[model samples]
Target: MNWRPGCDLAVLHLRARLMRALRAFMDQRNILEVETPLLIRAANYDLNVQNILCQDESTDPRPLALHSSPELFMKRLLAAGTGPIWQLCKVFRKGEQGSYHNPEFTMLEWYRPGMDVQG
Candidate 1:
């Protein structure tokens, strides 16, 4: 049975709870929440990842790619000294749907300056 969006109320409730929990966790760690653009000019050029592109007159007449992750821009912010920032936003990918994956989904990304994976 296909339920309308509002009919699926449990999912919404779960999402809200998760969001609040994440924010509190970040706040405890003194990490700042940020927002980034979903649309980007350049597509990520990895081997398997494909990007969705769209033509728009607002930014450019040419096709613009939807960002798969906020990694690139986040790194730029890190370089510019915006330290310890995290973002929870929607990202888009092309040809990546599966039983556990979707083309469009919410992503949580963060960057900490002067910190490496080993640390």
Candidate 2:
């Protein structure tokens, strides 16, 4: 069996560079970086979206759903007067494993309170 990481040195370097550039661009635009909870109690209701449920021992001992996106929580932040914010974090989804799809992957979510698609 070949034991090797999926990512190599060159790819890792490129990813770092891309992340740095993204952060720089966001900073230039005055967008704040924020983090939200990955483990959530409520799952998205979309039929096409599958949530990876995990057991929470401390609480009700019921299955807690992993977040598919930071959209809902970020909207809450906006309502609470956080202004424009963006997050680069990992999200979990079930039954999406393939060449372009992974059960768990990095997701970039951005929210601007007053901006529309054109703006």
Candidate 3:
């Protein structure tokens, strides 16, 4: 069956372009840019996402699975040494496909160390 292809790359690029405004906003406040992992071990069991599980064929769960987001790990970074970081990358979903849907798609995630989600 043929399916409609969404421009996820366009979505990613648009996302980056949009974030430039936010980055300027952050930069005005002296916030620094940081990068977290695209793959990680643990993830939130949340409602917005249905995740695809990926195993390292050669590693035998050494790294385990593809991350839903770098949220948990990024938060750990905040706890350790970094502060107020943002990340953008591709992510996988368990059972989704269409023009507005892709099995794997891009995401942008950010966190403020001192501020809550409302901020």
Q: Model 3: per-residue lDDT, tens digit, 1-119? A: 65866566889789788878878887776665667666656654566876666678676654445666667767788888776677767777667788788777777777776777687
How many residue pairs clash in each candidate at the backbone level? 0, 0, 0
Return the lDDT, model 1, position 33.
90
All candidates: CA RMSD (Å): 2.4, 1.6, 4.4
Between which residue pairs do clashes occur in model 2?
A: none
Among the numbered candidates, top lDDT falls to 2
Candidate 2 off by > 4 Å:
none
Error of 3 at 115 (Å): 2.6
Q: What is the Cα root-mean-square deviation between model 1 and the actual structure? A: 2.4
State the lDDT at 24 in candidate 1: 100
Error of 3 at 118 (Å): 5.6
* Local accuracy of candidate 1 as per-residue lDDT tens digits, 8-86: 7788899899999999998988888988777887747555789988888996787788988888888788788877999
In angstroms, give how far residue 88 of model 1 lies from its true place. 1.0
lDDT of 2 by residue, 1-119 (tens): 77998889999999999999999999999999999998888857657789998895886876789888888889899999998899999998899999999999999899877899986
In candidate 1 the C-alpha lDDT for residue 110 amounts to: 85
lDDT of each: 0.84, 0.89, 0.70
